[model samples]
Target: MIDQVRALFAKNTFLPCDVSTIADDADLYDAGLSSFGSVQLMLAIEETFDIELPETLLTRRTFASLENIAEALSGLVSKAA
Candidate 1:
């Protein structure tokens, strides 16, 4: 899931630095992820994972870092199962 999310970030986000080099828990916003980039990433994640994130989960906190994104996706995937 992390790898998938990482790949999605690489393809979808506007981060200035290499997504792979960012720490899993690092703040993506500080690394150059804009609000629009996060939205694009959210869409990409939904399409890739085949899960829709709840409205409540669509927040900066959920998309704050690679680890957070994976964690949010994990919960959504489990619930979908």
Candidate 2:
């Protein structure tokens, strides 16, 4: 999931830095992830992970970092399980 997220960031021109080097806990927003880019990422994540994100998780806190993204995904995946 992290790999997919990194790839999404790498492919997005909005991300100002290398995706691979981003720390798992690093804030993507602070690293230059624009608000619109985050929405794009959310869509990518849904497609990649095969999970629909609930509206409750579509907030800054959930997308703040790679770790947060993973946590949000884990919740959704576990719920589906």
Which candidate achieves the best lDDT against the true structure? 1
Error of 2 at 9 (Å): 3.0
TM-score of 1: 0.90
* CA displacement after TM-score superposition, residue 15 of candidate 2 (Å): 1.3
RMSD of 2: 1.8
lDDT per residue as tens, model 1, 1-81: 788788887776468789989999999999999999888888887888888889999999998998999998988888888
What's the true lDDT of residue 3 in model 1? 89
Per-residue alpha-carbon lDDT of model 2 for 1-81, expressed as tens digits?
666666767776657788788899998899998899888888888887788898999999999998888778877877877
- Residue 7, candidate 1: C-alpha displacement in angstroms: 1.3
Candidate 1 lDDT for residue 67 = 94
Query: Candidate 1, 65: how far from true, in Å?
Result: 0.6
User: What is the C-alpha local distance difference test score of candidate 2?
Assistant: 0.82
Pairs with backbone N, CA or C atoms under 3 Å apart (clashes), candidate 1: none
